[model samples]
Target: MNNLFDLHLQIGSRRARQHIQDTPLWQLKQFTRKKKVPDLSSLEKFERSRKRFERKDRLLAIASLSRFAKLDIGREKRKGLPEVILAEGKLATDVAKITQAMLKRTGRAVVSRLTGSQVKAVRSIIGKEAKIEYFSRSRMMVVKSHSYTPRQSGGRVGILTAGTSDIPVAEEAEVIAREMGCETRSFFDVGVAGIHRLFEPVRDLLKWEADVILVVAGREGALPTVVAGIVDVPVIGVPTSRSYGFGERGLSALAAMLQSCSLGMAVVNIDGGVGAGAVAALVANRVGEYRTRVA
Candidate 1:
């Protein structure tokens, strides 16, 4: 029995050797050879490449200022919408810091809803370093470095206000659209109360070949619906806080716009001029880009 067991073991050993011989030499070498560790110079080169990539990433990364804000520095590159600083609630000093940082990084900065004090702070901080265009009615400011140039997308935006009270909101939208490189034509004091006033402006917008229209209204907010019905291009309805009583603070206007019976009309939040303008600019820019490509 011992002799038989020894012969079986020898036969198994011979089969194992035959299988090893039949295996590919490369496969055998993979198991037999040790992986070569990278040399010091190669490791240094890889580290340098990694650091270079990290540097570039940092340039495009969100700029964090202590704990208060994380400025999206790469918004324009990523979304085609420039980052707009809303200075309504922030401290003036903080706004100034953010504006300076944004200007340094992007060569341009847009600030919306700026209080008088905030405006002063920003001007004091960045006045000598950049060119600041402040629109008092809209409470918006555009800051540009000396080397900065506004991009022209060959897009046109037509803006209309239902009433004079709604002009401030409409102005905000116009500023945003212009900053996005769209040519804007705006008309004010055309409300549903005086329906006839809208016809000429609507006709002019059509003749000017507007890519999109922003209609700003308050109270019952019927003007956007009217404009939407008349215009062939896209229409964005912006409700303002110019009403009173039960639907005060733009609630009624918001509701009316949301419930608009007009086709091809969209509504933003009450007093959301920034969002309205950004969306309109996006649509116009895309249209313009397509026109350019086709032409």
Candidate 2:
């Protein structure tokens, strides 16, 4: 019956073989007994099995912080990414507490949109116990336990900014990508206004053999479209809150990107460096795994 259910998943005979190898007989019996039927359809059995695994994964690791926040320490295991702390509107002390809690469980925490005071507070909390890297341009900070090491892998990310002002967001993306163990190459001040300014960096990125690219833009947000047209890799557009007056704070930029005609282009939220960075890293990680298998 278990083999039949696995066949219903259509994941191939190799995966079915893995299922039998990895799952204990007692555990499989427990799953089968729950349905309370000697005979059952494969779909019904699979649904029950899927839900059981989902619930187990979801409840695996949780840390409580004074009834205010419950940190999902199992997020990295379940989602292939760690849970990050957002410090944009939170008090400095609160951010520190959350970071400390996360570090206690996961050995690492990323805090985004951190103010200068928040950085000081977080450093004070961890003291000499951990390492804290802060980027003033991006307003992002990474806290890692003393035992942490960069788990380097196979793919590369190319980050580009349309203007100097967009560098902060690009920097944020770079820091996150590096932390996630993806090699990153950056290109700056290459907007559509000076089309020629982009050519050299695009060539350089190709030379570096980037697996994915992210383009950060503010005013018109056409950089990603242009990049997607040129690069064979996937392109992610980051719309920064960098303009004023008529369009006002990246509204026009966001809209323009959402409507981009380019085939392989996607857009993130206004000043959403963390989101873009995380997504790019995930793609790079998957590509790296594929390369490793093929090699």
Candidate 3:
């Protein structure tokens, strides 16, 4: 049933028509096979028919290291998305082994989280074979970018930041959106303190014709609400952990965004720019697809 639609044109006329009829009995037998079964065992008959329903999708490989790494080999076909590695709570050596394993299987590459010190360990492992980049604010190092060559798509997404202090989170958003095939634009460092500085870029972004806006901010996090009032499209607030003396940098921002007075606004977690970017891309794709269908 997994590939039923595609199989319609592939199978023999008689065999295919028979399959449509046999599926009901197979399903009924399967339902009673595990239960009381009325009298004799229906399981033996169900097992024979179950063989016809095997899934046709690619199997994901789980790589073992200090922790578990699940590689989604079918992401390209199923979701039109690339695979990413979340590098957290693991040692440098551990990540190195996992990355090497994934590279061997997919030759596609892997992204993992690492600190500056851990990058040295990873450098020793992969050397020049991999193209690695470090995100300073996210405290993460990524090892893969060859997975997808992003193409242009409609409904541009604007990545905005409160100030230079929020660059780390903004970078994560940029990385994610690029991989998702969205035509993206970014502007940073225009918070509410000097409200005048924001008007110019905000005006320019409207001209750019964005479908959604991701506002990355820390501290008081009043930027997203103000941005919502100005923009006509969806405004996603990203609260970053870029503060101190106030629930570690992110706590205050999170609380402020959650309690915002704006309507039709959404917020992602502290420094969760990747998730926010992916969500924005999904919305952009939907908008584009709907327009296409209308046209």
lDDT of each: 0.85, 0.85, 0.71
Evaluate candidate 2 by giving its C-alpha RMSD to the native, one decimal: 8.1
What is the alpha-carbon lDDT of model 2 when measured against the actual structure?
A: 0.85
List ranges where model 1 is wrong by over 4 Å: 1-60
TM-score of 1: 0.80
State the lDDT of candidate 3 residue by residue for 91-190, as single tens digits: 7776677767666665645354466656677778878776776666665555653553445556478888999989878877777776666778888899
Candidates ranked by TM-score: 2, 1, 3
Better model by TM-score: candidate 2 vs candidate 3: 2
State the weakest 10-residue window (summed lDDT) of model 2. Answer: 2-11
Best by TM-score: 2
Name the lDDT value of residue 119 in candidate 2: 91
Encode model 1's per-residue lDDT on 198-271: one tens digit a residue. 89999999999999999999888889999998788999999999989988999989998888888999999999
Per-residue error at 43 for model 3, in Å? Answer: 28
- For all predicted structures, in order, the TM-scores are 0.80, 0.81, 0.71
Residue-wise C-alpha lDDT for candidate 2, range 1-295, written one tens digit per residue: 5454444356346677456445555555566577464654554555567667766867677888997788989887777777888898899999999999898787899888998899989999899888888889998888999997767877689999999999999998888888778999998998999999999999999898788899999998889999999889999999999999888799989999999999998899999988899899999988988888999
RMSD of each: 14.4, 8.1, 9.5
Model 1 CA lDDT for position 46: 36
Of 2 and 3, the candidate ahead on lDDT is 2
